[model samples]
Target chain A: MSDLLEARSVSRSFGGLHVTRDVNFKLTTGDRVALIGPNGAGKTTLVNLITGDIAPSEGQFFMGGDEITGLSIPDRVRRGLVRTFQTTRLFANLTVADNIALAIMQRKRITRRFFSSSTELPEVRAEWSEILSHLGLDRLAYRKVVELAYGQQRLIELAIGLALHPKVLLLDEPAAGVPHDEAPRILEAINRLPSDIAVLMIEHDMDLVFKFAKRVLVLAAGRLIFEGSPDQVTADHEVRRAYLGSYADARRPT
Target chain B: MSDIAVTHVPHKRNIPFAQEAAGALVILALGAIGWFLYPDDLAFLTRLIGIAFLVLSLDLVTGYCGVATLGHAAQFGVGAYAAGIACIRGVSDPVALLAVGLCAGTVMGLISGALITRFRGLPQLVLSIAVGQLIAGLANKLSWLTGGSDGLSGIEPGKVFGVFGFDMYSRTAFVFSLGVLVITFVVLQRFVRSPFGLMCRGIKDDDLRAKMIGVSIYPRLVVMYGVAGAVAGIGGALTAISTGVVGLDSVSFERSAEVLVMLVLGGAGHLWGALAGTVIFMIFEHIVAAANPFHWMTLVGLLLILIVVFAPRGLIEPVVLLWAKFKRKGSAV
Candidate 1:
């Protein structure tokens, strides 16, 4: 399949520190990719570069063929490049439904209608109800985001990402702060995302990476060292030495 | 998940449908109380109405959009001068003057908003103060056009609609100001509950997330600044028209600070809170200033301290809480 998103030689550095270095990757429709890396490996930075949160020092990113390096963060999101934070960033004071409704309003471009009630708008009501319900969060719709459990907030993050109608969704550790037992529900929600959209998850959880990602990309010290199927990732000698060596050897390998 | 009929949300939605109508009624009721209590002092009430617009406008940018400003009177002053200049040049109709004020305010809002939205937090606040001082200075310097520091006079507004002439009782000005306030309140109430307004709240709550969700924060804030400007402009125009004079006070730095005080006194963010703040602050100021001519400042200071200490959110939050409690008790019974 043709690429939905492509980052060509994308690199970023803060002063002398090379946070993201010459990382080239392409995501096709329905691609399930988990990006695994050690601390300071620039996994989140790569996501930021693609999302237009930070600019690349040398390289360009494209969505379906259009160079999006020049676009603003919101404009890139408008073009269907969306992401969720490692730490849940939600409208903490607003209800869950309102948070989801904001994404829906932006998607439909109804955020400019200034004379009607937002909640009573039939289209908004329908969208949030459906989206939240699908994520099994309809029960928490009226609750303020600040009042929600950490795992549920993460689920709301996924719900919001889904609401944006993203073509390429970058989830930066969707279950990072989630309790051990509740992490799977978040994974379940992640699995339930629309099939046609490409999903790139930045995760350290090997079990989740194995289960959710069809292919795994390993990064170490700001470089793409390996990109292969989950099975092949452990077998690659260089990949084992640089980063996944101890974990892979411990999990089930030789 | 199959058995869950999740379409119908069970929680009681607090977003009332009759908000605009209810708001209009409340404003009218407030106007009537002012009318009865201070029948002879209609000019005082009219002045309150004029300042109410400024407070409401302040609420729009500061309370709703999350843009901290100390220079809101920049728009209010521009609007006053616009209406006053338009009238002096021959726009005699009251409605026409208000329109001039609205356009001028919106333009001023766009200009100031463009500059102010560039920074966040303290720098933004300082920038707003600078903008206000700049506008007020410009007004003071333009003596030929604005009557300089002496204030602009010779503003003779024709009949309300070319039929209802302003009588000696100051009845026309009071009623007109109140009518404008009620209409603006209803409209702003609607605006606050709309998608655009909610998006602004999203920005106020968390702008980065708003941007991540595809919200263009700058443009929305600029547009809201324009909306806020239009509201403040109308207030300035009303002040000029009702009193038949315009001066440096209209665009003064103190006017910006005082309007903000009023918004904070009543509440910020909620439309009614702005109106409530204006009423409480003005009335308390009036009564205290009357009771103690020399030490009036101390009393007002005490009141502000009391309110801020007891009700950090604003004067309205406690009432709203009590109201919610009262209703719950009623429902329980």
Candidate 2:
């Protein structure tokens, strides 16, 4: 199948040090891929390159066979390539519903209207409520984002990404700071997404990776080391020594 | 899903009609009060309204969009000169002058916004100040067209809809400016409540996230700046028409800073803050200067310091807070 999103030998360097090496990657529609690595593996950097947040030093990016390396972040988002940050980034002063409604309005191209309120429309409100209920955030819909707990904030971020109707969604550490008890909701929400929307998640939590990701890609020191099924990843010696050695020992049958 | 009751929390779904009606009534009351109290010095009150418009325009960019500009007076000056030049060339209609000023202000705003949005934070502030100075210097150099430091004169606005003439008593000018203010305020209220205005607020609260959500930040800001410019231009045209003069001081750096102070003092972001800030600052300046002209500057400086220390959000913020508190209490009862 033709790749919906492709990174062709992408390399990004800040001065003398290379952060992301010539990393060639591809993701097709309905693909559930987990990119796992140790700290400094350049996982976030690759996500940034694909999302058009930063430029590659010696390569290009394509979305459905069209060159998108030169496009701005918003331009890329318009083409249905979206991402969530490692740290939660939200309009702190705005309500949860307003934050999601803004994404929906922007998607509909009605955010430029200078007289009408977006929330007053019945269809818009229904969609907002549906998304809020799906994410279990309906109770706090009117509350400002700043007042929500950290896990709730993460869920809101996910809701915002989903609101864009992205074709390929890159989730950068969705469960990074979420509490242990609340992490299941994040995983459940991910599992609940429609399969047609290709998802590429960068995660350190092995349980989530094994449960949610169909294919696993391992990286070490700014280069892709392995790409295979979750079972294959755990058995690979190189991946074990380079990254997953500790997790493998913990999982071995006594 | 069936077990959980979907309790709908009341949201601010639309603009409150009662609040709008009260605002209109307040504007009318202010106009009547000014006419009654300062019948002979109506020109001074008219000029204050004009400055209020300029400050209101500035609030749209600096307060709403978080542009951090310090050279909005460039648009004001451009509008003033545009109106003054049109009048010199025999476009004596007051409405025509206002239209010319609006167009001029928009063009200037677009041109400056292009340059200003290229940088962030401190550089943005510097670029705006530089743009203001550049326009002021050009006006000074091009004396043949602009009338240079002698200031543009002979701006005799015809009449209100070819009816009431602009009399020497300043009655007609006062009414015309107040009418313009009321109309602009109403339109701006509708505007800031719109989706575009919400997008601007989103940009202000978190620009990166706004972009991530697919908002084209630069163009939105440029369009907002243009709208702000047109408003500022209207004020400049009013000044030229009412006073029969346009001066270099309209576009000076000090004028920009003064308006910024007024906007901040009244509070930024909120529309009523613009009116309150301009009125309070201007009245204080007038009273203190009348009492002790030499030390008025010191007194004003001291007053600003006290305000900054006490009401950092602006003078109107405290009243808004108090009103919100009172409403919460009444609703609880």
**What lDDT tens digits, residue by residue, belong to model 2 across residues B112-192?**
888998788999999999999999998899999999999899998888899989988889999999999988888887788
Instruction: Report clash pairs, candidate 2.
Output: none
Docking quality category of candidate 1 according to DockQ thresholds? medium
For each candidate, what's the DockQ?
0.79, 0.60
Q: Candidate 1: give the clashing pairs.
A: B152-B246, B266-B277
> Model 2 clash tally?
0
- Against the true structure, candidate 2 reaches a TM-score of 0.95
> What is the DockQ of the complex in model 1?
0.79
Cα displacement (angstroms), candidate 1, residue B3, comes to: 15
Alpha-carbon error at A226 in model 1, in Å? 1.4
Listed in order, each prediction's TM-score against the native is: 0.95, 0.95
Interface RMSD of each: 0.9, 1.9
